[model samples]
Target: MADDSNTEYLLDASLSDADAMAYVPDPVEVPYPDLEYVSTPETADTYDKYFYFHREDVSFEEALADIRDCDSLARGLNSGMGYQDVYSPYGGLAGAAGGVIGNAIAAAIFGSAEKRRIRRVNLRRCMNFKGYERYGLEKDLWQRFNFEEGFSGEAEHIRQGAIIQQAKVASGPKPATEELGR
Candidate 1:
């Protein structure tokens, strides 16, 4: 009989392992936004001023999602379920990781949802503006509706729906022979 260990070794060598393993020499650093790192009163005031002045360019839904992301990170950091890297010079690697995850989550929501849900939420919020209900004009809707809840839930729903739709399409029937001109 053939040696079992030798046969196993041969099988392992023949099988392609590219998909099962990766040899990343260095871990890529994740880019994260940190509002706490905004040093000085001037920097803080700048964001606030921008928020007030550029309300037209920015939507309430986007702001709400950002807030939720930050809030989630803060909660995670405070809960102590995170770890800190030994080589972090700033002693804030844990918070940085949290921020990275939060930002990634926020970005993923927008990308996966096709931005449909966020647009819808913003539109709904704009339509519900009571202050300018009489005029029916397009204006800064945030002045009337406070997006405390953010559009995170709606965005998530849209993302999930898109994923399901994508899967359904992928698993759908093959094109007709006539349609394929086969």
Candidate 2:
């Protein structure tokens, strides 16, 4: 129905470490825990649902380019850019191994066409594929290529944990926002 293979948004530091820093917002005064620090491969899987469908016609390099765009969008969001601001071609990097090596590993993971077909169907029902476009993809590649979706339910569970922790931080305690003299 749609390509899902082009879904995952992996982060690679192409920008000099300095430039990458610019994509992060300044620390908030309230001393909140860093969401970025808590981001694990599992958390990424929450968004990884986008790649559930894939197209075989598209080359591996093209697929990786698509994923890179997804990564860029993710960074922009983390930097405080609105969803509309980050909207454009190629949101972040794609492919396995951070988009540097492209999809060799992914193909290996999807060895059989039958397995891929099953994965795609499961992915659509389980993950939040809507975010994938901002991450890149009109439709997931797995649909086109019949590739199996790679994301696991574990990602959603872990994200829920992080959300709970963030909520606790927000509601637990506070320091005065105003300067001492003011």
Candidate 3:
């Protein structure tokens, strides 16, 4: 009789005992210079004298909130969500059917919306870039805005007041001489 006893079989040649996972190299982190390392004398002079002249009037958070509010408003307006037809149905149909004339009329109606959107987008980007440069906050504008409550002028004032109060507390009381003049 043929040997019926089961013999141990070798593993498939393609399957190795060792781990077959591909090597993954570690991620390389590029170093970014700190503000002091990057700032030139001229840039510092301009920033302090010109750009930040009104820094005390508005805190970073307030400015950021205002930027957010403006951005939100711009987005809402640009979305054309609430637009209503001003023209009668007949006029609308005529305008739509007028070929090149219709196209011109449509452009005239919507061109301002496009312009406003572009302006708002640019303004938001500028604010974000400026905030990053001034504060050394690693987050981009949208990321920073995510941490704040929804924008409101009243809320912004309250926040600014709180910030000012904190600053006063952190700095401690002014001397009698310093207070005497004010």
Winning candidate number (TM-score) = 3
Best by lDDT: 3
Better of 1 and 3 by TM-score: 3
Consecutive 10-residue window with the lowest summed lDDT within model 1: 130-139
TM-score of 3: 0.24
Task: Point out the higher-scoring one by TM-score: 1 or 2.
Answer: 2
Which residue ranges in model 1 land beyond 4 Å of their true spot? 1-91, 110-114, 121-182
In candidate 3, residue 81 scores what lDDT?
Answer: 26
Residues 1-182, model 2: lDDT tens digits: 12122222211324454343223222232233322223345534544332322332443333333433432233211211112222325546432224433334444444333343444333333222322212222123212211122223222222222222222232333322211110
Better of 1 and 3 by lDDT: 3
Q: Rank the candidates by lDDT, best first.
A: 3, 2, 1
Which residues of candidate 2, in runs, are more than 4 Å off?
1-53, 78-182
RMSD, candidate 3, Å: 21.9
| Candidate 1 backbone collisions, by pair | none
Clashing pairs in 3: none
Q: After superposition, how far is residue 54 of candidate 2 from its true place, in Å?
A: 1.8
Q: After superposition, how far is residue 177 of candidate 2 from its true place, in Å?
A: 52
122-157: candidate 1 lDDT, tens digit per residue: 433342341111111112321221122222332232
Q: Could you give candidate 3's per-residue lDDT for residues 81-108 as a string of tens digits?
A: 2233454456656644555465556656
Judge candidate 1 against the unseen true structure and give its global Cα lDDT, from 0 to 1: 0.27
